[model samples]
Target chain A: MANFLGLIQNENMKIYRRNSAKVFAAILIGLLLLGALIVKLNAPEHPTQDTHWKQSLQQQNTQYQQALTQMKDNDSYQNYYKSQIAINQYRIDHNIAPDRQMTLWSFVENATPIMILVISIFTIIVVANSIASEFNTGTVKLLMIRPISRTEILLSKYVSSLLFSLLCLVVLFLFSWLIGGLFFGFSGGEAHLSYINGAVHETSWVLATWQNYLLDAVKLIMMVTLAGVIAALFRNGGLAIGLTIFLMMGSNTILALISQYDWVKYVLFTNMDLNQYFNGQQTRNDMSLGFSLIVLAVYYVVFLGAGWLFYTKRDIKA
Target chain B: MGINTEPQKQPAVKLEHVTKKFGSKTVIDDLSFEIYGGEVFGFLGPNGAGKTTTIRMIVGLMRMTKGNIFIQGHSVKSEFKQAMRQVGAIVENPEMYKFLTGYQNLVHYARMIPGISKERIMEVVKLVDLEDRIHEKVKKYSLGMRQRLGVAQALLHHPSVLILDEPTNGLDPQGIHDLRNYLHELSRKEGVAVVVSSHLLSEMQLMCDRIGIIKKGKLIGVETVSDFMGEGEGKVRFTVDDGQSAAQIVKQKLSLDAASIESDAIELAIEHEKIPVVVDTLVVSQVKIYGVVSVTQSLEDRFLEVTGGKSVG
Candidate 1:
């Protein structure tokens, strides 16, 4: 077991020592910090004026009171009271508590797919290349002849790639947070932003507090693991990363087309993100949690298993 | 897995009709030989003549197409772990992580072999005389230094048998000389069975106790340096009076056609007793005998004959 651990450490050192990987990691961290700084600096201040709904109600109340006050001289009190009653009745009928129409946590919940969509596309390249580079450089043989089992070597690579992916996410989140906070502020207001009707609206929804960054890190790890498995099984980093991006991007289109079939939702990439499951979003096609979990497990197993089997049985002569 | 109850073992390595093929090409064809305990046995063969393939099979890197290889009486196929436990090998080229320091590479390999100690690593470092440069990364080391480091790594576990394939491939003349002397001391003083495979006959002729010549995947011959020199093993040569008459007289008396008369000398390929008989016959024949000398066949002639005059480059 110690020998195995030593081999794993050696494998990890090889990855960490690479100049290109180090540069990539540094760039990611820089981008994340930059993004966070930008967001922090550019966040708009909350509107100081009264809300439109509140202003409308105030205006109605003022108009009604003035009319009643002038009715003693003009005999308009009864008509003015009737008008106020009519206005109140209209409010009641329309149920216009528009004051309570702030963005909810539910909005952030629905946006989990977008979050995974944005991050995983970039993650595919990092994860895939981490393993595929060994094959490309003919360094796999050096690692294999160390009396360590193939499974251990593959697992070490998988774990290291996962760490790299999480690091990338950390960089991105740090930059996004800094940027988000710079334009916005450290305050939770406008944690979620949306563009509707050519106007950018700040949402009160706050999904990632500083503490939730850990969970974000774990989620990034899971995504990278999926990509790492694909990378290890594929010929090179490019194909693995390209295919992973294709799956993430084409997932919605595929789901739309496959929704006509009863069983297709179980395999959709959008459904694979665990946060999506918690959100109670409707699938394009109905898929039970049990079924999706099984499918994902199968995929994880096949990807990991195929990588191990191929690496072990491969001719290391080259 | 019982120890051979026999009191003493004859040889450290023995290959019994070991045949191996890669696809349709026979890389090693029905090879059989032995290396006795504590001797530097040289395995001489040309490029693509199955030296590397045989070493790989012996080290359990590749399985044989047929037959078995035994190290210290443990079968390479069936008892590989046990057999490998006693044997150390560096086949073809010696390569290590250029990024790792010499000490790091040695320690890494040391950890793989069970029961290896840090002290053992230090010992090997000193043995290879790389103590000063051991901490430097391999990429900074010269070719000779790297080869020494390779030998150090292979010897770290103190395996009884060391197999080196073309150990001097990339070294300068001084480096080769250093290696040759070092290997000789290791086998002679430490009593380790060292098997060196090379195409250079002169080195083997100088270094090996006995040699096995392989050609086109076949073990063509195995002979002691003396036997390989043929019937001229310790026999005296004669520059005698009337060299042709001496040859005729000796051949007529002994009834053997082993004497060849040159212009100046007669080479009497004779047993110890025949030397006395030849001198008396020449004296009785009234031939003016000028000199009596012993000539042995050169290593080149022996090598050429053993390899059947096959081209070696």
Candidate 2:
């Protein structure tokens, strides 16, 4: 166990020492700060005077109803509008504030998807190069000749990649929160209002945000594992990163095109977005959170299994 | 076969009929050899003769198709970790993480095995004479410096067997000399069984105590440096006043084949003991001999002779 931890430390040292990794991290945080600044600057000069919660809620309901009537053919947009309308109606009926103030929690909630996208891209690049660059640089021989088993080395690398992804996620969340709090007030304990199961439900902002972050982390985990498998099989960093990013960015379009098929729900991308289920917006009527979790579990095993097999059995000729 | 009589201590590295096949094409045939402790064993072969392949198998980087390798009494196939703990290797090239500093690379590799102390790392750095630049990033290091760092990393664990394949690939003359001296010192002082593969016969002749030559994926010969060079009869070149007369007298009196006679010299293929008799016969025959030079065959010549004229790369 100590030896494995040492290996993980070694892998992490290798990752964090690289100039490119440091630069990538800095750019991610800088982009978050910039995003927060833009949102703060775009806020209304007199938020409380011009935009009352009750009045804004009523206006948003009317606008959603108008858009819903015009977009009857679009099922996804209709579902989104219906959920928004339901949430607005609930807030109006219960006399709950519509969360007009941009709090730190709100900024985090709004930026969750963007944060996931950035972290996923960064992790995919890091994980893809982790194994492939060893071969490219002929350093695999040094690693293979060590006293530890091949499985241990590969596992350490795999775990280190996820740890790096987790680090990025934490950094993004904390930095966004800090920047948002500095610009917008750290006030309000507004609950996350959602429309689920043909009714309205309210959840704590922290709880809902944590669940969203966890689900987003799952998508990044799948991408990292897929990148690792590709890197191990091909031993080319460029190809691995290219393929993983391509799959991640094209997932929505690919799912839409293939969603008509019954078996498409079993595809990795179709089940990646666990947040949809929580938001009462299932991309497909058949996809539940439990079903998506099962599909992701199977894919995670296959990706990691194939990667471990190829890595342990390879000849390390380069 | 009965050269060293040290009560036959257990060999540090032993290969039993090891064979490696890459998809039906056998790269290493049934080859067996043993390297004892406190000796520099030179692995000599031409290009593509399976020297690297054998080294890879010994270090467990590449699997052997059919056979077993034992390092310090542990089988590499079954007890890889145990076997590898007793072996250190640098195959083909000494590639390291260029992004990391030399010290960082050493520390990273040192963490893999247990009981390696900071003092031991410092000792190895001193051994390889890299203490001056150990803190610099590997990307800024020269090839020779990187090679020394590799040696230092390999020695950090203090393995019983040290395997270096083409270790002198990119070293300058000074670097190669230092490395050769260090390896010899390592073997003598620490009793580490060092196995080095190289194409430089002169360096091997000077650096190795014994050598094993392979040809076409087979072990052609294994012998001490002196024995290998002195296996066959040597050539004796006699520079005389009359080369033609010396040749005639040598042929008639000694009844030996005078290999060549050019200008004022006659060369004959004869054993070392036969030189005095030939000299006496030539003196008695009134042939004034100015000089006699005995030429012993080099390892390159013996290697060619044993491998059927195939040259070492």
Candidate 3:
């Protein structure tokens, strides 16, 4: 176990020593600051909050109730209206007013989607290059001739790539929180309201935001894993990077076109966004959270299994 | 047979009928050899004779289609860690991470194994004479410096079996000389079995204690430095007067059936002691003899002769 940790340390040294990885980290930080500045500059400094938030929420509830009644025949799409109505009714009963001003947590929530995209692109490149560049530079010959097994070496590289992504994720979360607090006042409580099982529950915004970031990052995990495997099996960094990025950028379009088919739920992209269930959305009627989880697990195994088998068993002529 | 009671009696690396094939095309065909401790063994062959392939298999970088390799009595196929623990190699080139400093590259490999310390890393750095530029990135290093750094990386673990494929690829004359002395020192002082592969015949002649000549994936001969050079034997030539009659006298006296006269000379394949006898016989027979010279065959000539004149890469 200690040896394995050393291997991971070795891999981390290789990853962090490269200039490209540091540049990626800088880009992520720069983008977060840019986002904060954009939001700060575009907002009205002295904007007044509406004092009648309860009344407006009540009025919004009535409108949602009316829409629900009119759309009773379309019961399949009623969860959206039902969730909103339950949240508003609970807010009124509990005397919790809806946020009318930007707060620290809320700004972080706004930056999640865009920053996640940048982080995913950066992580995919790191993961892909980690495996292929050894072969390209012919360093793999020396690397494999060590006392360590290929399985351990490959696992170290695999884990380090994910570790890099996790580092970026943590940095994104913390930096956005800091920037958000500085730009928008930390005036609101770190409480988030959610409607589950027909009840509105209050939860820690920290936990909720972390869950949100990680759930939205399901696609990133899948894509980076794919990239790592492709790089290992093909031994081509550029091909892996280009192919994985193309698939990531085209995932939504590809998912949309294939959503009509019955087997679409089994496709990797269909199950990547595990957040759909939490958000009261489903791409298919049969895909529950459990089903998506199972699908992702199977693909996760296949990708890593193929990569491990090839890395350990295939001859390294390079 | 890398198992013997004596510490230096057994082979450090033993390959038993190792074979490798790509699809139906065999790359390495039924090759077998043993390199013992305290000797510098040269693996000599022309290009594409599976030298690199055999090195890869021994290092566990490639799997053999048949047979097994053992390093210090550990099977490479089963006890890989134990086998590799006894070995250190640079398969083709000393291709270190270009972005990493020479020190960092050493650290990177050191971390893969247990019990390698900063002092040991520094020791190897000093051994390779890379202390002045150990902190510089490998991309800025000269080819000779990289080769030295590679040697440093390979030596960090104190391996019993050291394999260097074309170790003189980019080395200058001085660097090559230094490396030759270092390898001899390692093999002699530490009982390390140093396996060196190169196409430079004279370099091999200078550096090797024993040489194994391979061709087309089969070992044609494995001999000690002296034995492989045919024991310095060549045709003894006699530049004489009446060469035909001199040759007739030598043939009649010494049973030299193949000795013949050409260009007013008679050449006989004989040893040093027999030259005096031939001259005495010629003089007694009243045949004039002017000069007697022995034309010794060099390693290059013997290598070309053995390999059918295909040039070594």
Candidate 4:
């Protein structure tokens, strides 16, 4: 056990001191920060009308003239009514763009899921490929003959990969936060929205500070584990990363469009996102956080268990 | 074959009918061998001759399909932890973190062994003669240097048995010689049983007390250096004046009919003690001894003979 722990420590030291990992980390951080800054700075400005009457008149006149022409030719009041209402709504909402700070905060809030997905995919590829690359490099044979059991060696590797994935996510989060904070002040935490239709009403609940951040981190870490396990089982880094993206994206898009199945909601990424938990709301189908957690737990267990079995039995051939 | 009677004497390592197969391919076929305390045992075979497979099984890297391997009477399968406690091995290559320095690699492996002291790390570094370069990253070291560092790491725990598979594969001649002498000293002075597998027959012959020859996934022979060389007489070849006349005279006068005459030399297979008798016979026949040389068969020749000159792989 001590030897196994020593191996994990040694693995961590390699990641920390290796120039390639450092360079890769730096590049990821720089790219993420630059992306955040660019998005923040180049935000589309909200139009403020100095000539509100002129603007309103121009928009209304165009729609009215079109409506009058349509009514004169086909005598259709339906087209006139639709055009008049749409034109009036457009004029009012055109100059009513969201506040700059609010827009940026919303952008970040939406982008976090994608960013976590990207980092998770990258972490899985890097960690999984490192292990597989040892075989290609003929290093695994060297590792196995070290008077230690194969199980301990592989477990140490898995633990090291988890640690590395966490490190990468933390870096991504820190840089994203720094850029978001610098460009758009951090005063948008209590953001919310409300919608009402007929007798139905819905509210966008604000996220609690700790629960939001912690759950997001946990989900991201779990995503990394999923990717890592896929890579380990397949022993193809690119395939693992690509499959993770496909699975996460495909599950939400395809499953959401299909007929609403109660069980499908549990497995789909739309519900997998813990942001709903922070939003203090159930999913469209009213799936609970506990159900989502259970689904994720099942996936995590099966993936890791399969990975462990395959890795232990497969020959460490290059 | 005598039963070991010493009160505390124990075999360093033992394997019985250890067979391992990968799918349809049989790697190690009923292999059995033992290394006694304080002897350097050479496991000689060509590439893919199951040397690595056997070593992996012994080290608990790969489980055997049949039979058992024991380290100091601890079964590798059931008592792997206890078995590994007194065993060390470098199977295919030196497994070290390339980014870590040689010293750090040694320290990392040292810490894993429960009772290993920090002082032992320094001791192994010096033992492998890598103290000067220990601080440099392993990736920066040459192949030979890396091998030495690997040896240092393996020896950190001061295991009673050390198993190395082709430890000198990537080393230069000087490095090979250095490692050979170091391993020799380790076995002799430290009383550590060593099993070193290699394709380099001459180096093994020089260092090993006993050589186990494997061919086609099976151990063909296991014998001491002198025993495997055989008790037969060494060959002596000579070029003498008037070899044809001498052959006729020797065949008639001294019953030298078995002596075969080549283009330039008359060859006589004679024991070392009979060299003088052959010389005297030639002189008595008025045949001048132009040249006389004795040829002893090398381990390579012996191996070729035992393996029937077939590729072991």
> Evaluated with DockQ, which candidate comes out highest?
2
Better of 1 and 3 by TM-score: 3
What TM value does model 4 have?
0.79
Which pairs, if any, clash in model 4? none
> Candidate 3 — which pairs collide?
none
Order the candidates by TM-score, highest first: 2, 3, 4, 1
| Location of the lowest summed lDDT over 10 successive residues in candidate 1 chain B | B1-10
- Please, what are the lDDT tens digits per residue for candidate 1 over residues B1-313? 1111112355678888998877898878999887755678888776677777777777766668788888888887677657777776676667776777898877667766667888999998997789999999888998788878878877877777898877887778887888889877777766778899877777777878777878889988887765676634665778865667777777787675645668667776677777777778778878677887777767766667666776663
For candidate 4, write residues A1-318 as lDDT tens digits: 666778888667655676768766777777767777777567667645455564655666677777766664332243334444444454455533224343334545555666666666556656666656566555566555445666676677778877776676667556666666666675554333321111112233233222444566666566666766776677676777788777766775686476355566656365567665433233443456677788777877886787777677765544
Model 3 agreement with the true structure over B125-166: per-residue lDDT tens digits: 998899999999999999989999988988999999999988
Give the docking tier of candidate 3.
medium
Error of 1 at A2 (Å): 2.0
Native-referenced DockQ of model 2:
0.81
Q: Candidate 4 at A119: error in angstroms?
A: 1.8
lDDT of each: 0.64, 0.86, 0.86, 0.69
- TM-score, chain B only, every model? 0.79, 0.88, 0.90, 0.85
Residue range A146-231, candidate 2, lDDT tens digits: 88999998899889999998888778777877887887777765778877766899888777777888888888898889999999
Query: What's the C-alpha lDDT at position A231 in model 3?
Result: 91
For every prediction, compared with the true complex, DockQ reads 0.15, 0.81, 0.78, 0.37
**Alpha-carbon runs more than 4 Å astray in model 1:** A37-147, A163-185, A189-275, A280-283, B1-17, B32-37, B68-87, B114-119, B229-301
